[model samples]
Target: MLNRLSIRSIFLPTLVGVALLASVGCQEVPVTGRNAINLVDDQDISKKAAEEFASIKKMQRASRNPAQIRIVEQIGRRLSKTVFWDVPHADWEFAVFHAPGVMNAFAMPGGKVGVFSGLIDFCENEDQLASVIAHEIAHVAARHTHEKYSQGWMLKPLGAATSIGIGTTIGGTGIYVPSVGSTAGGGVTAITQSAFDRGKELEADHIGLIYMAKAGYDPRQSLRLLQRMEEDIASKGGPTANGWLANHPSFPQRQIRINELMDEAMSHYEKGEVSRTHTVIE
Candidate 1:
């Protein structure tokens, strides 16, 4: 015989049990040992990425040199295949912008990669370029952009609406917030953004080296690339308030971390799982 109070208690517990089961049935991230909250579909990001890439191609001056474009794509394809074989139809596209002054490369979501020609001037050889590509690939594989978006969203409206779950979101779609602290207060300042950027760079380096070795590139290239970046920074005498170099860890500290991570990366290499292909850019 169940009274109204007893029935109510049983119903509440049953409802909670169903919700717990639903939440626990989410996906898991590989290697990172983290559960995922992927309410936003990967296809959505991929579609957005393809559209944005189309516009980028229209606006940006692509490298006119066929040899250079081929080399960059060749390296990019090798690295992409090595890291993301599980995702066969990833739609990875690599483009080299003819901008000589902007020594930068970014891996956008859904496998769109951009390499500014200036980065080529900075990197002396393929190994160095491999290092950059590995780092960017790490950012993609790690799903850092999605993590960032989830972090902000989970903290904002979702936190108010739902309980804080262990795996809030790994990859998801949401309106971009201008700053991590956009609604709460003033946007993340240049100083704070610099610090955050440095942290991301370090994470990228640590994970990127593993990626390089995993793809059969010598892990030591990671260290060499940091050293060269350091020298380039010194050549400028001091950091500018508004530039890529200013938005990262001081070259010295970054160099040290790169060296430290090299040994560990070498261990992963010794396992001999990575595939290798070497071809001349010219």
Candidate 2:
């Protein structure tokens, strides 16, 4: 039978390691001020993202429409200026992909933003497009990719520790324990990671609202754009809210959260010079 000293020997170092990791990796997310773990090297992540962004640009067909290019670049320049200090390492570049039916946009680390032609066509005005761009930029600004990697690093060790503890505790007993710790740890990890991703998406929406407002886009357009998207999803029979397993919060839930932050975003919008004109996408 293992003594109390044996348990201490196993756990003490693990506890200390976790504490050291948290202390060294903790960082406050910009705009939201939430403490997040980000252990990945910034330069490495940026370099990889830049490389991937280049690959995507080469593989995907670029939009040849001058109007699409013009609007995206215009909004990109304005939002990039507003977020300069938040993402200092960003070499901001926006590209429009020629996919006319895929309503999506993405932003990578080091400030590579891409908009599918469908998303541009889907937007009713410049402000709506700006809202989506700002949301993607918020993901980069929040360092979510780095945070996700850090979380994976932490979780693997934690799961292994749980398995070890279970094995050690039952070692002397004649009872057969069937890897219960690993199974339970896996379940917990999946649930926790999904919840974390949902929280990050909501946080991005919050940060993006303020960003678009600061960049002179009407903050209310963000709400309108979400409402429209929600309606579209419902019309197409897409799941509105996928409960705990979904990475993104439902459209209605996002709108509700953004509604709470409208007053603050509107104040920023009122103070900013309204230079972003509504460009109707034809």
Candidate 3:
């Protein structure tokens, strides 16, 4: 559907949002306190995310498994409590959706978290599950989704302009393009997207490791989970499932970096830690 839309239609609003960013300045991400190019307001993004989350709940069937619900809620309750004071007016809700073969999960803005049964089944233990939850929560805490909106408004349209120019030069069709030109433009878009996603994945891993540790999960378990993912990728000859793993850094490289953060994350752990007990469904 979006493919049918004109490039200008997509880019113009984005250009306006970029200008708005210049006038309003940026927002600092919580925990990291890093200033991110926040073109859209955080509260607005949070509201939108909550709306989307509600829509998802409406469309998808939630898991009725008591154990699934209990485990997800327990871990979510623990991890979310750590940042409750720092995040005000936060309405945190956690749910497990029963979407067979949908290997996906997310912690949207406004603290709405959802776990897919497929992901829980795929995970060997609660540690791996926590790894996914913590990473997603870090995405929320660092405002990665908001940064993406800002980046989209500022960069994507400009990238489209560049694509048009490239198309014009190669096919003399101006903003219009031949199939070859379309392919070339898509290639540029893919490269730029991959580059941006790399940094976000690294940041999520760093922040998430700390969150999981503070929540009484072992930081080293994050590494074990990543290694398991690497094995999955190896077995499949590449990252097979889409979305989360699509642009994530190669498991080997990501695990290497996560390993470097072990000491810092482990410092938060104690000899005996309380963590949710999970028995993988399948």
lDDT of each: 0.59, 0.72, 0.64
Model 2 misplacement above 4 A: 1-23, 157-196, 240-245
Model 1 RMSD in Å is 9.2
Evaluate residue 273 in candidate 3 and report its C-alpha lDDT on the 0 to 100 scale.
Answer: 57
As a TM-score, model 1 comes out at 0.70
- For residue 114, what is the lDDT in candidate 2? 74
Cα RMSD to native, each candidate? 9.2, 11.2, 10.8
Task: Give the per-residue lDDT of model 2 (tens digit) for 1-282.
Answer: 879988776666556547757676688898999998776678877777777678667766889999999999999999999999999989999988776555667777788887777778888999999998998888889887777666555545444433321111110100011111343322222212232367888898899999999999999999888888767766655552323225577777988999999999999999977576778776
Best model per TM-score:
2
Span of 10 residues, lowest total lDDT, candidate 3: 168-177
- Please provide the root mean square deviation of candidate 3 (C-alpha atoms, Å): 10.8
Cα TM-score per model: 0.70, 0.78, 0.73
Better of 1 and 3 by TM-score: 3
Evaluated against the true structure, the overall lDDT of model 3 is: 0.64
Q: Which pairs of residues have clashing backbones in candidate 1?
A: none
In the range 165-248, model 1's lDDT, one tens digit per residue, is 212221111111122233211211211122225666677677778777776777886677777766665665545523445546
Error of 3 at 2 (Å): 28
